[model samples]
Target: MKNIVPVKWLLARLYEPDIVIVDCRFQLGNSNSGREAYEESHIPGAVYLDLEKDLSSPIGEHGGRHPLPDIAELAARLSQVGISNESRVVAYDDQGGAMASRLWWLLKYLGHEAVYVLEEGFGAWKKAGLITTADQKVLIPGRFLATVKHNMLAEVDDVRESLGKAGVTLVDSREAPRYRGEAEPIDRVAGHIPGARNFFWAEGRRPDGTWKSADEHRERFAGLEQDDEIIVYCGSGVTATPNVLALEEAGFTRVRLYAGSWSDWISYEGNGVAVGDEKNQ
Candidate 1:
């Protein structure tokens, strides 16, 4: 709940000048659908930020499917959308906060500490009779700057070194089937990094598609020590962000994101891959 805001919380501050709302709705294969959806109807005054366009850089040989965008370019884009350093940002998506969390993580990494993810998806907002508009608002550009946080990320080498090491937990945020190598819908590799434990990212949310409480999140990660160094990853880097946010909500202080994730791990020939349920160390 620390970095998540409810619909009511957003509703009251909808028209505020300093509060900027971003729509981060994205579907993996249908990239254009997100933009089209936003154009159709969205929360009034919300600007659409595409995942493939704004959040990630072009794919390379090693940086996985969705590489981190260049900080300066992203900052310029943020400024164009009127997001300054003082802006209180609220990002939302219909995909259970998966895409929204990417922006949330990126903003935090950029050292903008006022960013938060919307608790419920956009559909819930429409169902509750909240306003939705097709009109786009013209915005004055802001003076946003980037101050990258290097400590929030874990490179492939950092993960490789942490393998089988004490006081470090490598969490694979993919589904059970993908983690167990039963089925891989995306990515060339079918298995996970060796010694990584599976913790599906959607588990952080309740059955109703809303996020769980802080105590509930703590229970989800009860096996993990608060002091342990937690490294979270998914197929690419996108879905892993929810787990990163969840860990923080659970009161874990040492969480870091493996931005390249499994796709990048297997891009190298020498990396080890595991195919079954591994015991949590």
Candidate 2:
């Protein structure tokens, strides 16, 4: 519930015992890349969470490249990693906040509130001249419970129900070209949900790949109704978490993530995924 903390604040909390820092730096081209990075060096006293091993049920065609694993499995994983209900978690990745926010939203989706994404990520940490260590950590086993909140998710039915309705805003977090159907890297189809606005999550990143200031970010979501409920999605459920965090940071509290995202949405046989310059639509 607190504001997104800086790397320095996280370093200050490094030895708190109740703090859990997960390094999420994964290369999309090679899944094992993150683990290699962690093996080389990571935040002093930080642990590596393999995107495929530690997270997700498994990669599949219908489930996108990475699908949300069952709640019980995730709960058990967190518990196995020594996270408890009282533990405060900070998740981060090198590619802006895309991968980091996945863990952040997963904690929230599984109903854990004490989670936050490292504002800039591992790059920012190294840039700050922070210490790194290759020492492996051993977790003291503890029980962690999650109260799954399904309402925070929006399915195709909910999107259909809200279309043409007043005070409901849809945002696609995919790149502009991808949202326009001009490019398709991971998914079979391009474009986005009809009546959705574009806010490419990568745009929030600076040239150095750190997140922008709250003021500048707030301006990005400007002109939208603060009272309107915001539903955000991307290739899958991952990238959209940054948008959720961004809007929440901007003081818009009525935000939800379409966990299925565009990948899941387009998989629907009859769903409408529009193409073209949908910026103003």
Candidate 3:
């Protein structure tokens, strides 16, 4: 399955039975904004999925702010939303694929390969002058079986083990300031993991929000070999997914997400956190 689907292609197949369009518009601080936006206007046949409610599990002291939902519960939610293993899933959001990529990665982590993030997101759809609707569509539920792909995820232990490993790379996908410990708007600490490198997730896109070409991505990540293990993380594990997608596009195969990321790391009192511009280098 393609990692991205164009707005024109999605418009052409809007009503296909095996296709499921998901509205993933969300605001980090405003929980009700996404649902309210969907209720006001959404693509025909698109169903809403909230980042906090549908995508994340209940936050605890151990996991990050946006922890991964239980596999069984997530699978059940997907089944309830008419998503089977065979469905062609397309997710979109206003935040330049940040929120949508989470859903994209989650679907893949659950062993479903027919999922994609819509290029340019709902903003592009609106800009294209396409049709939207306020009416809701009811879909018959599907029987989606869940299978966990453990290799695609990295826990706090794996991250600690990879800190100074020769063949591993730990990537911090937040902005340079956040990664450098100069400024931290969220989380308790103001720095990154001791040995991690910075690769801002938004760099994957152009100024207009479309993804860069595959060749460009390959060039951006040319330093790494295909066999090297890459572990990506962000403030709370949400934004790092875009970097994971970018790495895959660059032809890097052995990549994993640190789901707890910096938030969970700092929660451990003994964990080492580096604060300074030098740490980013």
Top lDDT hit: 1
Clash pairs detected, candidate 2? none
TM-scores, each model vs. reference: 0.98, 0.93, 0.97
For candidate 3, the per-residue lDDT at 210 reads 89
TM-score of 3: 0.97
Error of 3 at 163 (Å): 0.8
Please list the C-alpha lDDT of all candidates, in the order they appear: 0.93, 0.81, 0.90
Residue-wise C-alpha lDDT for candidate 3, range 210-234, written one tens digit per residue: 8987787887776666799999999
Error of 2 at 40 (Å): 1.3
Arrange candidates by TM-score, descending: 1, 3, 2
lDDT of 1 by residue, 201-280 (tens): 99999998889999999998878889999999998999999999999998999999999999999999999989989855
Residue-level lDDT of model 2, residues 136-155, one tens digit each, is 78767668898987877787
RMSD of 3: 1.3
Which model, 1 or 2, shows the larger TM-score? 1
lDDT pick, better of 1 and 3: 1
